[model samples]
Target: MPALVRAGTAQQWPQALAVPGGVARLSLGPAAERPVVHAGDIPVLVLGDAIEWTAIVGIPLAAPVGEAEVTVQAAPTAPARRVAYRVAAKQYREQRLTVAPRTVDLAPEDLARHERERAHQQHVMATFSTPLPEGLQMRQPVPGRRSSSFGLRRVFNGQARNPHSGMDIAAATGTPVAAPLAGRVIDVGDYFFNGGTVWLDHGGGLLSMYCHLSRMDCQVGDVLRTGDAFCRVGATGRVTGPHLHWGVMLNRTMVDPALFLPA
Candidate 1:
């Protein structure tokens, strides 16, 4: 299992995980309304009622393993308060595979397509919505054996690639994938690497993505509640087989999806 570090007064979903590319939830006592918290310049999610407010911080993968902070502004007129957090180093294992040459070395046209998709997906993942969700607990989008591949440094055809950013669930082709939380469809497209993908904006810098889908039932701007079937699993993109690449993004950074999964 991947090591996790957590801190906070929150009974559920605590504030800080010192691990690089982890999440921190900060509790800001009592508020008239939801406060605005910034993890750097990006707005973090503030969730609460007329009572306490909490900020969900997404620690980046590149963040140095040490102390970090976020700024919280209770109201528009109020000054921002800096809240301290810690980030610890977590080592990920390396995996090597021998795949087809084409999969390892992309053609010029494929590379161009990937660049465009990356830009568009980045915008979609950065979406911040009003009326933040109350909690981070999420239902499994599909029923299958969860592969602990998150953060695995992958080498394909002797070439080092980026660490895996999402959790992979091994499932059969055409397996249904459901929305883990209420969200609006912000992006749906076919890409070079991700294949058919769907991005959901779940308000307040909390987003979810489903990739390598065989079919997409939801379109952009569509609203879906938890358990709504939005797509079917497939081996569309560059994949070994049919499975769902589920990702959770907080503050525009991809954190471990397992953090949001039910215990």
Candidate 2:
């Protein structure tokens, strides 16, 4: 089993950016044990312990620019209390691309495949485990120029779709991708939109995903340390070129991956 983080000395928390698609770190005060926290119905990642507890929340990109609250309970039978925070608006740039018409408008078979993949991926994303003892900071998985930023409103073939939910790193085909943090490989598969994909559970409702890979070296249940090479970059899915789509998810919401890295 992974070690538990010492209450106040070891962990390096992610920067708190209280905006849509950002992270909000709220203090939960001191308690005898780690508090149970939730943002609406989604379980949240809580760190620290008796000395001090903190709730790390991932604000969704579509969240309104206003106040939000989380419910916290020190114990199972303890009354839940609300902690409120503000989510500011952020304007991300837009990107337009011309991809194959087939990818933009999927056929019936492809649509069905996509729906199945989506359901499976959702289950994978919902995984939560014991909180990792190590710090929350992460290194870059693959060194390269950032081809695309997160939250970019994307338009393909003149049809607008969901905002870009991850950072795309420009790397050559077969460029090795590393694990940004120590984690357990929870899922690995080829998908309709994400292509060759790998999901890593970093524990405590924190997860990271790598997509558009040429190859995957790790399998489900593989434990990897930080900087372990686990895959290679590629243009496997509905992409214009070879790149890595790196996503960091907290509490089942995809937030800005940059918040976990050094500035």
Candidate 3:
């Protein structure tokens, strides 16, 4: 089957109830054939048959829970069409954790190193490649129980920290992790928080990241297909045990990885 034909049959758009810090899959239908869509200013992934297209929208954690809109342009001379979607409210659980004080508070040198790492990651997350992804359905990178820690507002040692941005899968150290979809490896690095991380660009603004790996098998610019082993799970970062931190990025925002799981 052709790539677009296969993608059209495999991908199903989620309903239009956009939850904060979540994802909203909107269908443009036949009218949007060959459309270029954007959620706000950020371009969204559009995939489907010749008659219809679907837009995968990433709702920011801070996005207002209400009506939201996306712009679609079918051609260069065609007028942009605004498609509105509803953003529903979702309440994520709060978690309080007590860890080593130094982990929360870094020294001057550690802080500087962290700052540099953050800048580099920000650039990686902002990558928007041409040729949108064929499909968004993803296979789990490793076989394990998923931790219900995603989107959890965490308070560490009486200090508020950012919400958990990735889905944590508990696995044994050195467990092989596979690629969730076909994509090119865009970034690979070890950082202060995410050790042995690999980021894949699944075309357009769709990206996925695997962090805290015990080993990396692929290098930057490597093309990986679905189910291909690319890394190994481990307790490499600031974590309690061996696990895989899998993140799905859309339009530069880290949305819930569960959204891409097969229904």
Error in Å for residue 13 of model 1: 3.5
Off-target runs (Cα >4 Å) in candidate 1 are 1-11, 14-16
Q: Going through the candidates in order, what is the number of backbone clashes in each? A: 4, 0, 0
Q: What's the best-to-worst order under lDDT?
A: 2, 1, 3
Q: List the residue pairs that clash in candidate 3.
A: none
Strongest candidate by TM-score: 2
> What is the TM-score of candidate 2?
0.94
Name the runs in model 3 displaced over 4 angstroms.
1-17, 31-33
Lowest lDDT block of 10, candidate 2: 1-10
Number of the top lDDT candidate: 2
RMSD in Å for model 1: 3.6
- For each candidate, what is the lDDT? 0.82, 0.89, 0.81
TM-score of each: 0.91, 0.94, 0.89
Q: How well is each residue in 4-28 modelled by candidate 1, as lDDT tens digits?
A: 2335433565336657767876667
Superior by lDDT: candidate 1 or candidate 2? 2
- Checking candidate 1 for backbone clashes, the offending pairs are 15-24, 15-25, 18-87, 18-88
Model 1 residue 14 CA deviation (Å) reads 6.9
